[model samples]
Target: MSMSTSSMSAMSSAPSAFMTPASATSVLISGAGPTGLTLACLLARQGVAVRVIERAPQPHTGSRGKTLNARSLEVLADLGLAGDLLAEGRTGLPFRRYFDGAFAAESDPSADTPPTPGAPYPASLHLPQDRIEELLRARLAELGVAVEFGTELTGFEQDGERVTARLADGREVTAQYLVACDGGRSTVRKQLGVAFTGTGEPEPAMVVGDLELTGLEPTAWHQWFGPQGALMLCPFGEEGDRWQVQATPETGPDGTALAPSLEGFRRIIARHTGRDDIRVHAAGWLSSWRVNVRMAEQYRVGRVLLAGDAAHVHPTAGGLGMNTGIQDAWNLGWKLGYALSGRARSALLDSYSEERRPIAAWTLETSAAGMAAVREGARTPGVGLEAVRVADITGLSLGYRGSSLAEDLLGGPLRAGDRAPDARCTDAEGRPIRLLETFAGDRFTLLAFGHRPALDPAALDLSAHLRTVTVDTDDPAGLRDTDGHARRAYGIEGDALVLVRPDNHVALTAPRGGEKAVLDYLARL
Candidate 1:
């Protein structure tokens, strides 16, 4: 039977002790955080059956990932959630610091970040991680997929054919693959015997929580310098007068988790700002946060794979922990879907680990450096951008240049494996559009720019899944670089062809008449 037929058969199976009713999905995901939710939502959109389970009875209410960078905005834009997210987010908010209740220098954190034709999102956005998960969950619901809350993956054993996972409710779920997005202390990673190697920062653990308080302007992001550290109170979303507070108490250096209580919160608020009048009315979520710098040695072990916090954890320095994980899901989701549907071989799934692992390692280092700068009093809390550049912080500078999937041509600065930059171009009707719009949806897009194109749509034999847009030099076809923006952005002097993968990265670029080269590159990936 075909893979889709087999997948349907699995979903239609009856319940039993060894395999339960929920055992039918092709991919089983653990931990319904942003990472798992994104992966689940992506797969579901592609008609891949996925079962997502979270140990917690309810969705997390904490505002952990408060900043969504530019690349993350692009990822969300791909899911059609960017418009709603932008509506619910605050943008280009300034960061102001006060020392001893006296105003220090105020800095526009994202002032230097200008939107480009290809990259339209802002430097960063102020939407909480909880809100992001809500969006993903809503998308999943639209696809008829609901997260299985209160269901935890106790353990799982995998083989060549399938993976059988045991839930906390004494149920068994058999799936073609298993992915763990369950935080840093991942049970799946542990069970798979993946070595998580890193050291935990011994600095006194800090507390972060969301609170509804009075007497603070929700416009400017505030930071108060204290004897211990900088106290942060960032306003998120325009819905109400809510804020996320991060502060460290002067309690003796005891290795203990701080309890999130009203009294404790008030005390920290009073101690840090030396103000007793600011009312701490009620708290929404509270938790302890510490610097744990770690990464899994391998992203996959057999049928079990890891993403998000399950695979790596940073000090929340560059605000990249959540964004990187979201990108990870975006990278893995479509590939897994193709593999599950048998449109692509299982080798495509291997690229998930190979591509994401290095990015995670780089994120860990950059975030670690940012954390060190903050702890050393050289930078303000939540203002690590002083140490990190705009490109790195926005995650646009990252590319799989050395990736085996890339095929480079010595024409433009952007080669194969580079992110295909956006440019203002016109379609056949002379209507202006950006590359982001053209590359929307889950399909490989081929752009034949300016001349003797490497690939031909009429004569070429290609997969039915591929999308082709032809651009001409003199007699323009479907797409045209009217003002030579495409020529400049894509490095097309006379003639060139660019093949962009589903994730918006250039898979292969070749000189004119290199049609066979492009085909060979596609076959290899």
Candidate 2:
């Protein structure tokens, strides 16, 4: 018997071609950072075959990328990891500046705005990056996936259909896609010949790391800028003087960049604070980094794709490096899952670069500008936070308002490609539920508002793939909006329809008669 052309095409991506008898790995992720772990978990939860490999032999303990902005918390919540994070972390850490052992100014990095009906998470919170990674690794483990530590992607070759990755141990694994979540020095990116282009600080930035100390209270994030150089210490972890220390290195007369060390940090802190009381102990991970204000010329080269620091690296002013990468993973996870399962055409994968590349460019601009403003002792750029009004750092308004998938037939406050706001409501049993909860898991949510234009369920029967929820009680999935948050957020004064994508972004919003447009949109996907 001969195989049909379509059947042959399917066989090209069939898991049987490689690995165990079960199936070929659908996706292979490189690096075990938050970005890689989040992507691995999302795809694995959907029952997609995913394997994550990290060059590091064990989990890192560095407190790098420490800020979890509101949008990041929302993403974590969507993945079911937010509760533990919020409970373990505090949002009240204030930034304080001291000069010559006297306090000068104090400011709040986390916003103080009240939670709205549409958005529940606080504006910003501080949690160590190591803790966040541990949480993500825990979540990934729950999905029955583990990062293969000490395993590195030595090289790989991709053809028209599948990517074959060579492990450091000389083993080859084939998959439908290869995603590089590796850091600034990405081997996968280099192998792809993708140019990481932008300006790097002529002088390499100094070291920053976590240190267990004595005499300093964890009450406020302490910083001292004196005649020598500046050193900042922010308390981290659940307790004690487990603080992150960031300081400028003491350069000699030769103008050579000196290596970062505990002694160097202590000396610099002493010089800046002019205090002998603070004692540095048990020094944790320390490394120097010049934030490479660079981004990949493109996000992908055929079957190999880049996310996280692999795609872009910038200053830590907004702490957006990790958040952007996590967002990149989320955006790509659902599209890849559905496409691999044949729910959507493979071409849908092209949107990954289209939707994310421009956002990364904007992140570069915001981060660079923010860092510059901080150095010049000014507020953040108009695109970033104000130090006092740190809400912009939350990244709530960051959306793909210009993506091709976004269609705005009926324009309003929330347009196509905007982040779908959440609202509190109850299930049919009158049990408590949130709008964000409904959008959770792996399915597109079709929000049929209390029919400003009157939508009937018989009009569309896509239950097999779509989760339809009717706000204002007209059907089985209806929610009685007693507080009317859903109505207000969706502009539900009249009949309207909203189609949210699997990643919880508004894909289409139109009047009630636009049901066919919704049906047609899914059919095309």
Candidate 1, residues 38-155, lDDT tens digits: the string is: 8998898888988999999998888888888888888888888989988888887887777645566578767787687767888888888888899989988999999989998877
What digit string (tens of lDDT, one per residue) describes model 2 on residues 1-525? 232343234334323233332225889999999899989988998899999999999998888988787777888898899899998786867777765556677766564654688888887778888899999999998989988999887777677888877765666788999999999899888877778899897775667888889888788888765544456788875466578888767787898667778888888777877789989887888877785799988787667789999999998777788889889999999988998888888888889999998888888888887777655452212111233222367677778888878998888888999889889988778887889999998888888877533334675546646887888756666787868888788775877889999888999998878877888788788
Best by lDDT: 2
TM-scores, one per candidate: 0.91, 0.91
lDDT value, candidate 1, whole model:
0.78
> What lDDT would each prediction earn against the true structure?
0.78, 0.79
Candidate 1 — which residues are off by over 4 angstroms? 1-22, 202-204, 252-257, 378-391, 452-463, 473-477
How many pairs in model 2 have backbone atoms within 3 A of each other, for residues 3 or more apart or on separate chains, i.e. clashes? Answer: 5
For model 1, what is the error of residue 384's alpha carbon versus the real structure, in angstroms, after optimal superposition? 7.4
* TM accuracy, model 2: 0.91
lDDT value for model 2: 0.79
Q: After superposition, how far is residue 481 of candidate 1 from its true place, in Å?
A: 1.9
